[model samples]
Target: MPWTLPSRPSRRSLLAGAAGVAGAALLTGCSDDRPAGGESGIPLERRMREAAVRDSARLLERYDATAADHPALAARLAPLRAAVAAHSAALALPPAGSRSPSASPTGGTGAAAPSAGGEPVPPKPAEALTALADAERSLSEARTIDLAGAPGELARMLASVAACGAVHAYLLTSTPGATS
Candidate 1:
């Protein structure tokens, strides 16, 4: 297979993205620019949503391979994956791609292999849930910060994401151990 270069960023696209982010910052005061070591100010809600989507994709890929054993679990997980995909699309985040389990990761000698056909893979789920929770926690902290200082839409959107994250966490934890 031939490697294709990523498309160059267009000036208009760059400006538009910057404008959205800057507007978000100006509205929410969550700008990336801050005094050294200060808060990142990036909205946690958006971050949480993005993270959840990514986690969902990875989990779906794993579930897809093992769905034969747990049809109901796979079915339940399918909607969750769809929800994640929808949320990711709404936020304009990149989608996950399929890759073989044997592919080597850049920094390690041992490749990160998919588990044996029916082996329970707890760590991925655990790590994903933990990250999702952390993102929600961060959003909560951001919400507590004075929104009187920034833009209304940014603050509102951030708060919305916090709520979404909480809901996502509950959904993830409540799912069965062997989903289809």
Candidate 2:
């Protein structure tokens, strides 16, 4: 008997299989079994959220410092800085028991000003932007790596914020308004 070739997979079947694989991947990433509560009694997810907020605040401070040190770039940097500020606020946690865990971040109207501290801004405008871009890129990579450990809602927010940071890094280096 001759062996026959198998029929091609239907589009719907293919899509369904793909979705299952994607979901499994997400589940696998989220299945990290580290202890739920740490020495401080805060759960891993909460600590992750807090750390994200602090990182955003520091990034915001860096943006502000860069803008102040290089006033000429201020106009170009304002929108990106505002975006960072928004990320910080969105990552802030509401008072304990004040809101549902699945609900979005709340409690703070804005991130408290943070300082990256000590390092002076670069003297040249291009150099300052490069430094800012570097910071954004580094933080974005860290957040991306962190998604594996984050729970559902927090993971989604981290992904969004991380994408934004990457975009900010790109924009700072190649401003659309520039004639180049």
Best by TM-score: 2
Listed in order, each prediction's TM-score against the native is 0.33, 0.72
> Candidate 2's residue-wise lDDT over 9-87, tens digit each?
8898899998997676467456442446445666666678778888887787888889899888899899999898788
Q: Cα RMSD to native, each candidate?
A: 18.9, 6.2
Worst 10 residues of 1 by lDDT: 103-112
How high is the CA lDDT of each candidate model? 0.46, 0.78
Q: The CA-based lDDT of model 1 is what?
A: 0.46
Clashes found in each candidate (C-alpha, N, C closer than 3 A): 7, 0
Candidate 2 structure, TM-score to reference: 0.72
lDDT of 1 by residue, 1-49 (tens): 9998668988988999989965665554544323333436644433443
What's model 2's lDDT at 76? 89
Backbone clash tally for model 1?
7
Q: How close is candidate 1 to the true structure, as a TM-score?
A: 0.33
